[model samples]
Target: MERILVVGVTGAGKSTLARALSGRLDLPYRDMDALYYTGREWAVNDDLVATVSRLADEPRWIVDSLGYPEVRDLLWDRADTVVWLDYPRHVVMPRVLRRSVRRTVTREVLFGGNRETWSDWLSRHHPAWWAWTQHTSRGREIAHRAADPRFAPLSTVRLRHPRDTAAWLAAL
Candidate 1:
């Protein structure tokens, strides 16, 4: 597929899948977190809609995002396919916790020169907590969007398990 959108809750492996798909499909990869963040702060481009709309006009690209409310419609309208990582909470929570721990321990730099810290991991706004609380709601939202008639042109591949995701990527 050409314009692909990888969507899921935080720590659901959207970035990982998008990167792999970009390499396999020979499409450029973009992460919304990088675009929206600036040095550990939320600093969206001045004209976010225009910027994203312009990016969507490109011939080929794969994007990973949390489906920000402001740009969800734009992304859905532009994407020819959506890869939804819909792993269950039981599968996702531990992964998120481990990822947070590893990032914190390693001081791994992330988008916008940000690094996860133990204190940040324990914060209410932590990615692990976000994923735990938003897991079901995010899945439902993606499913609904994928089924919507307005987005009929967009196809979706929903992978409910980590193994399913692996198989799907292998088959690609």
Candidate 2:
């Protein structure tokens, strides 16, 4: 699929799947986090909307996100295919937790040159907490988007579990 958007809850492995799809399809891959966060301490790109708009105008791309608020609708409107990783909370929570813990333990550098800290785990914005708290709501949001008439041209692939996603990707 061209002009793809890989969407899901915070820990649903959207980035991973998007990368795989990009490689498989020979499409350009873009990580929303890398584009949104541009500096240290998680500083954001002020021109994110404009930047994303430009990217969306391109002929092909695989963006790993439903997108942040400001650019979400634009991306959705431009996307021809949406790969939704709708894994349940049981799957998402452990993933987010393990990812956060590993990042903190290793002091791994992330987008914007930021690193996850044990202290960051206490923050509401932390991926683990966000995934846990927003799991159901995020699922509802994605469902609504998938059914919306405004995005009628879009073809959606909703994967309910990791195994389903694995098999789907393998087939692709």
Candidate 3:
């Protein structure tokens, strides 16, 4: 599987897995978040389509977190493998919370010059909150998409634990 899509709920280590896969497969890695969030605009921009198409032109790549239907189809449709990091709700929610708190406290820059703030951290839309809310939601989302004929030919793997993910990545 050359072109791979590493998908999961927020704070489920999607970017971490994507980087590991890129190294294991000797392919380039791209963070979909960087393309989706441009500091100039808070919302998704038009450049996303071009970036996705351009990246797909490469023979091998690992993309982390793609959710927009068009963007999802572009990568998911062409990706040879879909590795979902389906960690437990308890594990991910805590991790996301910790990460968010640390980032907000440190004013860490993320995704194209954007920085997490205390206000954002407290907001309902914070990724930490999203990680919690979207926990079981992803399974439901994936189930329907997995059933679609468009994804019939895909090589799918949903890893529930870090050990399985590590072993799979190491085997790659």
Candidate 4:
């Protein structure tokens, strides 16, 4: 489907799946983090809403995010399909931990030219910590959004495990 939103809690691999779907479906792929974090030091793009709204108007796109507060409803409203990664904490925690460790150790550059540092692990914003703390809440939020009447007619593909997602993607 076009105008897809790949959504999940932190570390659920939303970006990875979205990228894969973009290639498979031949739709433009947009990483929300890249769009939101526009410069060094994670400087936020001041025109995020305007920029995202413009993208939402496009005929075909696959974005990896639940969307930032300002654009959450807009993305959901415009999306024809939503791919939800609903893996359990057992599956999510290890992924986030490994990703954070790898990024920190390799000094891998991420959105806005920012790299995860050992010190960054102390922050609540760190992926590992954020995922651990917000896992349940995020799942609830996603569930509510999926069930919301306002977003009706939006086709949803909810994957409960990594294997399920793999099979679904293969079929797609």
Candidate 5:
């Protein structure tokens, strides 16, 4: 699919799926985290909206991002297809926790040169905690978006399991 928008909770593998799709389809990929972050901080780029609008106008691209309100409408308006990774909490919590631990242990640099720390991991704002708290709410939001008549022109794919995601990608 062209102009794909991948959305999900923190650990639902949105980035992974977007990257895979980009590679398979020979399309460019953008991770919204990288666009939203600056060196070690969450600073919005002054040109963020315009930049994304420009990308959205492209013929083909894969964008991976959480459904942040600021740019949600902009991206969704341009996306021909939306991929929602709707894996359950039981399936995603461990994935997020392990990812957090691994990133912290390995000192992997994330977007904006930020690295995960044990202290941050324990914080309420941690990705894992965010995922746990927002899981159901996020699912409801995606469902609402899918059912909205305004988005009628868009095709939405909701994957409820990891295996389902794999199969969808394979079929693609």
Candidate 6:
């Protein structure tokens, strides 16, 4: 539990879970999104590599994100625990959609002014769209990592339903 990867499809409560994990484990909470989203141009500066290296040296941390392959190696090599919120597609999609609506309506700035617009919400690149398209694809990849012999010692807790995830976290 020293280093935990809290992963899930878009809007599957990854950030919330990661925060809780950080509190429970007495570790730092790293929002990978904030670390990766660097500028107005949306380009990741070379500093991400350095940040990852620094985080890896720490004895404990809870990282929240799933799409950055560039930092995957650093995280995989250091994490001993992975909390996968493998909620059903039906559940995750609605959660994402609602979150989008709220953010857009409120003009909530996320990840340093990265915002949710109604038009973009309806677009293909929307978080909802990403969730729909990437859920099973990424989910399968995570499943493979959990079961693969190369990662044999990794402890993966795959929570299929929200209630199940809640119960598991409550007991932690």
Residues 1-172, model 5: lDDT tens digits: 7888898999999999999999999989999988877566556677778788888889998999743577888888888889999999999999999999999999999877888888897778899999999999988988898778887798999898999999989997
Model 4 residue runs over 4 Å out of place are none
The worst-scoring run of ten residues by lDDT in candidate 3 lies at 37-46
Rank the models by lDDT, top first. 4, 2, 5, 1, 6, 3
N/CA/C clash count, model 5: 0
Q: What TM-score does candidate 4 reach? A: 0.98
* Two-way lDDT contest, 1 vs 6, winner: 1
lDDT of 2 by residue, 1-172 (tens): 7899999999999999998999999999999999999999899999999999999999999999999999999999999999999998888888988898999999999999999998898999999888988888988999999999999799999999999999999998
For every model shown, the clashing-pair count is: 0, 0, 0, 0, 0, 0
The candidate that wins on lDDT is 4
Question: Where in model 1 is the C-alpha error above 4 Å?
Answer: none
As for lDDT, the candidate ahead, 3 or 6, is 6
Better of 1 and 4 by lDDT: 4
Q: Give the local distance difference test score of model 5.
A: 0.87
Question: Against the hidden reference, what TM-scores do the models get?
Answer: 0.93, 0.98, 0.92, 0.98, 0.94, 0.93
Put down candidate 4 lDDT per residue, 15-92, tens digits, no spaces: 999999999999999999999999998899999999999999999999999999989999999999999999899999
What does the lDDT come to for candidate 2? 0.94
Q: What is the C-alpha lDDT of each candidate?
A: 0.85, 0.94, 0.81, 0.94, 0.87, 0.84
lDDT of 1 by residue, 23-122 (tens): 9999999888777665555455566677778888998989998456777898888899999998888888888989988999998988778888877867
Worst 10 residues of 5 by lDDT: 36-45
Query: Global lDDT for candidate 1?
Result: 0.85
